[model samples]
Target chain A: MTEIDWKLSQDIQLLRLVTVGSVDDGKSTLIGRLLVDTKGAFEDQLLSVRRKRGPAKESEIDLAMLTDGLAAEREQGITIDVAYRYFATPKRKFIMADCPGHEQYTRNMVTGASTANAAIILVDARNGVMPQTKRHSHILSLLQIPHLIVAINKMDLVDYSEEVFKGIRDELGAFCAKQGVHDLITIPISALKGDMVTVRGDNMNWYDGPTLLEVLESLEVTDHIDEKPFRFPVQLVNRPQTPDLPDYRGYMGQIVSGTIRPGEEVIALPSMQRSTVREIVTYDGNLEEAFAPQSITLTLNDEIDISRGDMIVKPDQMPKKEREFSANVCWIGDEPLSVRKKYWIKQTSNLGKVMVSGIEFKTDIHTLDRVSTSELAMNEIGRVSFKLQKPMFFDSYAENRATGSFILIDTFSYNTVGAGMIV
Target chain B: MSKRKLTQLQALEAESIHIIREVVGTFRNPVMLYSIGKDSSVMLHLARKAFYPAPLPFPLLHVDTGYKFPEMYEFRDWFAKEIGAELIVHRNEKAIAQGMNPQEYGVARCCGALKTQALLDALEEGGYDAAFGGARRDEERSRAKERVFSIRDEFGQWDPKNQRPELWNIYNGQIHEGESVRVFPLSNWTEMDIWLYIRQENIPIVPLYYAKERWVIERGSMLIPFYEGMEDQLREGEKPTKVMCRFRTLGCIPCTGAVRSSATTLDEIVAEAAAARRSERETRLIDHGSNTMEDKKKEGYF
Candidate 1:
């Protein structure tokens, strides 16, 4: 925020990251070390810790307490909810959302990993891989968070042996590769000892690679925005009909995908008004052009009645505008996904009256396979069909996460009951 | 302004202007909450730009706690007079007259009665359907989860976990009767962004933000100043020491402290803020307590 180009100088890259493992796997400890070393913690918070927790006993500080802030969470010594933390290196910025690993909170883990770019599955070198690890890996594959890092933590307890590290890493890597998560990075680390985290440790002579921070900083954000279809949902209508500037109505929204420029032919959705791009407008005024996720205002040559909840797109790249569609969903609420349940279906500004057409299938998290089912329960991940009252256009979730991604809103309650990636 | 396409600043300005207009069109009887803070000041300026050729459509509500800086009042009066807005000033005179100093009744309780409660009481009394606030997301962790049309219960409480899922840009302001919503047009703005926008737009704000000479006493890590009716509570080991100080964030004197600074100008303040060793919330004593705002929000304390 200090720099006008902070978003650019530290280019905004949405990285979907997941930290998965069983309890005492030192997942929280690793994240805490990253934040502290990166200078993300404030002095007051540091001061509070120094005054209360005292010095770290011949070791590094407890970084886990910084994130697990709740009294219940601290008392239980575990993370309950998916807490999102924002940090940036000179090269890129990362949005790390850590998920809870309790078996009861498996739904929370799926919720956390649904939008991730990479998966950090912590493995205790001594304990090796457990049933929960397989479940986590299965969920990661099903959700399609591309990258994977198998961090074999607590290597010190294993006498910092490379043989133990290699064995655990090899087994998990083989399992994940079989599950279609081919892109994997294996690292042996001691979260408690600050080994291969922010700083390299002396014990790991067998490893020759970047530290965890280096790997995270260097990991490509995967510029997939270029391939997704163009979708821009208008947020505001800026028509300052003052004497100084009249006849200047612009439709504003961040581009969900694809590109836009002056003179490019576009269509206003629902209304289906075909118009030429008169100009590209922004809060800063007009841009020569704009791309996906960059909020811009488009002024058309025609005076079409486009309001909020309306979308704009390329004339040819018009999404699949249909009344019914198949989707892969993660049910978040206690309320089950039943047939004929009317709720506010929010797509990219094309709000539709949605109901469960039929429960097509639900995925078994342990197998990464689909199971034919009629309904979804709390924390249940499944594939289902939805019926909307009106036709709203969108691409598949695999094709475009921006336009394809949506949440089910309970009409009266207004709770986000389920998260969906359109098929 | 002559048919010139929008710049990034102008684009942000335009989007904010549109948000202001929607608040007017969507709500029954809308009002803008004027705190005279820099954020509120920017909101007011944008409101003026939003509905130019016509005065601000909504009446500006300033829930005065009577513990404000004198300069803020002066600026408020002058601006209100110049803008010709239907300015409504509400205060809980009973609480003030009862000598319920923040020191005695606790900061949270005192703020609850004077500021938060008074504001809620005023909104209910005025029947303001929607009130525009200058809250930004980057201000605090809790604030980071805030949406544009943040719906509050009839008692003016915010439920973080229970908020409506706001997607794209459209906001849902619809609520049951007796329940009002908070409209934050500057939800994306950061502290540095506010200063930069102020510098870019040349918006006028109170002089207290800049370094200035005034009788002050230092306590804890902050410079406790000599303001009217405000008493200093120094512990045994503490002593009153004066140093050049200015406010990064401002509220009631007891809660909002002056940080030690030499940056007297806006540019200097921005630079100082960039190089500062502490978070802006560190100076805000209300946030010092782990879940102070969260608790207040839960208890109909707003």
Candidate 2:
């Protein structure tokens, strides 16, 4: 064992990556190889994996069993849902979501890609760019994942041929270009053979780019969250009616985007009341200024009927406050979406009844074509318009992910039936 | 815009606070599960921070199996008072009265009746619509696949195959009556993150986490501490030996194992944790059989 370097460990940045491909494209295996090659898997965890599904040789282990944690998944010999796995090198800590690639599980892919800084869409070298690969890439682009990594897997099966790699790269690259993928890095590797993943094997000498892990470690996360306009959705109001602090009325929320400082004039939505930020409070004393992704309490200069489900933002940067809105929704409920049904929509600490006023069209997962459809079944993506019971404030999902996305809950079952992104 | 950015730890802290507040805002009633462990300590800290000036809006629930270490109980009470939050300690009195000991009925039966069933009973008693736990994805294999806001059916059973698709930071807290959701604010936090956060926040934890001279007897590579009334459970020729040990995870007194360590401070513990070869739950003895945690979770074990 080596001595642990606390400085490096504590200061390492976090990179969230998602793996997406067809069912046999080996997303789980790629993730498993990453964990094993990086020495992130624990001895006991590996031991259990080997005991259940490994080969007779101690050195050789079944990688897929490490994930596919559910019994049904193992029984079926495929991943059905998204599994989050963590690994790290000296420079960065990585959180990878191994998403299922079956066409019916598009919801899982979207869920996994929702928070990813980068997405690795595997392309089987033997098959080239399949429809599922394009579908995953399209969804990743739709979700605005900054980085796109095209891992042309199974190079060893193709005898590490450059022609095979180039063919798939150009095809997939052209398709991704259509999707507006700005940061695209395509690599050739064999996840099963452990080539060009963490280490560049001798077979891939023709490829000069960095390894997959290297790209993941070095890719700068282009997050402009703090630079965006300040939007705070009050989740709770803090008031200690105790004798010690009688006049304290603080608005608690996480700054979804941009920065905030004391004395900054802001307007509260729904109520349209304006006030200045008196103080930015946190557990570790008062911060001089707070930025996006920081959960803090704010004391206003004047308390003018502010409560939960209210948005506070700078007057100059106002969000669209309306009762009618349109969004792209991925229907995930077991029951098909009906236009007559009224669903409960929860977005940014606000919940209200919403009716599906119209269904513009549904995106065909296989061809990426928009077809007119009146109803959306399980795992179908569609452009839908809604009429809310009350006016709510929101931005387009592309502008601010935190304030722009909402989940539709079933009225009777209360299950999260659909996920919508404000258009 | 100022060039200020949140560090990884700070980002994780902010994410957890946001999750805690979401539960409080969405659910009619919510409670935090306090297990008197390091993760629970960090979770309680985040909860307090979520609503700083107003104190905690929810109470803390501890599902006691009556097999916890005395030090854990003391620290649990002390910390509950320190935070000025309501602490609800519930135990399966029927199972205890039935003399359901780990040695007699086996680890699975004992834990099922005591810990698992007690948690369900406690949730029903409080009528809590949502319960917050400190379960992290990095702890176990099955846990890695669980959602941040995991829903349980009317029978308090988890259907891993049929889970809601969680997207973005927006969690769906909607649940029918008799059905509840388990919110793990620390879902993304790993074991290393937990220890590091403990050190960064200077969160006080049970002293048993620190190494000290204690009487212990080895059982299949595990250092079983010598708690009161353990003499009868010891084998015929086995004798307790004094060794410097500390617990990596805290649970029932009879099941939780102690590791040989000299770490007594947060810094040393963090360093030790970083260099640990095996997983954290390896010290938990009751985690026997394959996918035991998954089985227990399906049966409503938090």
Candidate 3:
């Protein structure tokens, strides 16, 4: 317990990953194995797992039990919701979301993948490229995850044959290619036997690719969000109005996209009142330039009308300011979508009443088909048109994930019922 | 322009600061749940940074169990004054008058009355619509599935099955009149991140986190701190002895346990923490087995 190098561990970068596959495809087991080998799983936790279900051998304990945390999930032996797990090595730190693989939990998987930089799609080697595998890949592609790792799990069931692994890999590889997945890595792994996960065991000597952990650690997490157009969604306007600083009116929020500096010409949305950035302020000090994800305050040269739930952006590259738009939505509420119902659309710093104008088509994820459907039921993905009460500043989700994505809140329940991405 | 990528610690810090500001911007009345632990210390530091040059918009609420370590009380008072923050301390006097002790009523009943019930009563009295806690998702199994802005019902109960979908960084903070939101700014932070951040920011925490020679008694696998005048609580054939130990987590006195260690400095402690194999909660008496935390959370335990 005393061999840890603090200096080396502290210098690691952060990576966010989501694991997706079919039910009983060993998604939970792969994650559990990674956590255990990295020393993320404590001895007492492993002991408790063993105590719950006595293991025939020390290595055969049910690793999935470590993450299927809910009472119902434990009773049913299935992951009902997404569980976020953290593990770190000297090279990097990871914030991985263990997503449910059941087809009914597709909405949950989408929720988990919304913020993921990369995704690990688990493919059962015994059953190569199942319908669920294709469905998961389609979702990941639609979400625009930068990197993907297709771990061919249960290699031992196929006798760790290189031909079996290659055949499955090529089948899934071609499928991902059609989906325009640029960065994909395929590895043969036995999640149950702890082979080709964190370590390169002799059983996988035929496989020369990096282990699953290595791909996760070595993958570049460059999203280039700052390179996109500047889009700042003002969360709050700071007017502390102290005695010393009587007239300090600064707009405070996290920069969702692009970089901004003092003396930059910008305009607040809806009002369209133009002004110049006087100062970019933060707790540290005034910055020459501030980029995406950095929460800071800004003081403009002109005292225009601006408040919460408003967007600030450059004058040249304005987002689409319209009340009507088309989007792809994943409906998750128990109650299906009703055109008559009025829902609150919460986009980047903007909230307004929205109504379903029309339903274009619902996706058949298994075959990647768009079938015309009027009703958007639970766990269904569909293209829909919405008419908002007021104009909202946004970009295509493909262009700016921070500004293009939104959620639908049920008016009465106040629960987030649907996730939407602008077309 | 080519931008510099933030290290893991910096990224986590920014995310937490953003969350802290969301509470101030969204809720009318909010209070920070200060437990005086390492995580709480990190949270307090972030709150100050979130609204720098301006004092914290919300006050800190500390629910005292009346059985916390003496060092925790002193640190709590001193740290609050140091930050120039308004600290509200509340204790369940009725539960104390009824002679509610862990030894007498067991860990479950005592924690329910002292910790869970006291927290609910304090929030009600404060009328706080949003309460910021320092719970992390990586600490337990059930917590891993919890959202950043977890909504609690009128009675402060958490509905695990029907949690709202927290997408990206945008949080839906809308709630009913009686409902409240329990926000965890450090939901993504792990134990390692806490120590790394403490070292980076040079935040001050309780001295009990460092190794020290103190009177202790061996209780099962945990080392229970044996203070003077508590001899009656000792079991048969048990005697207090001086030992070098430090607490991995702080909680109520009778239930919390200390670990044997000699890592006094922050750097040494970080190394020891990285090397430790057992979970930190294993030392606490309240966390007996799985599902205990989930059940207690349903009844409003911080």
TM-score of every candidate's chain A: 0.89, 0.95, 0.94
- The runs of at least 3 residues in candidate 2 whose Cα sits more than 4 Å from the true structure, single-residue gaps closed, are A1-3, A6-8, A338-341
In candidate 2, list every pair of residues with a backbone clash. Answer: none
Candidate 1, B176-274: lDDT as tens digits: 788888888986555655776788778888888998766566665667666644444665665555567788887776677787778888778767765
lDDT of 2 by residue, B1-302 (tens): 12676677888999999999989888999989999999999999999889887778889999999999999999999989987889999999999998998888888889999988999999999999899999998888789999999999878889998888888888887777789999999989988888888888889999999999999988879999997678988897888999999999998888889999999878888888888889878888767654388899999998
Q: Indicate whether candidate 1 or candidate 3 has the larger DockQ.
A: 3
Candidate 1 stretches with Cα past 4 Å from truth are A1-24, A50-61, A103-119, A124-146, A222-228, A238-248, B1-62, B74-90, B123-152, B158-206, B228-242, B289-291, B300-302
Using Cα atoms, each model's DockQ against the true complex is 0.22, 0.72, 0.68
lDDT of 3 by residue, A1-423 (tens): 124774336557788999999888998898889888887888898887788786556776789988987888889998878999998876778899999888777777887888899999998888888877887788788778888889999999988999999998888888788767755799999888889998888897888889988888789877778888999988888877889778888888889889998999999987999999999987778999998878888899999999999989999989998989999888888788866577998887667899999899988876667898878898877898999998888999999998889999999989888989999
Query: Would you list the clashing residue pairs of candidate 3?
Result: none
Q: Report lDDT (CA) for all predictions.
A: 0.72, 0.88, 0.87
lDDT by residue (A369-413, candidate 1, tens digit) is 678876788767788888888887788877777677777877776
TM-score per model (chain B): 0.91, 0.98, 0.98
Q: Which stretches of candidate 3 lie over 4 Å from their true place?
A: A1-3, A6-9, A55-57, A338-340, B1-3, B289-291
**Candidate with the greatest DockQ versus the true structure:** 2
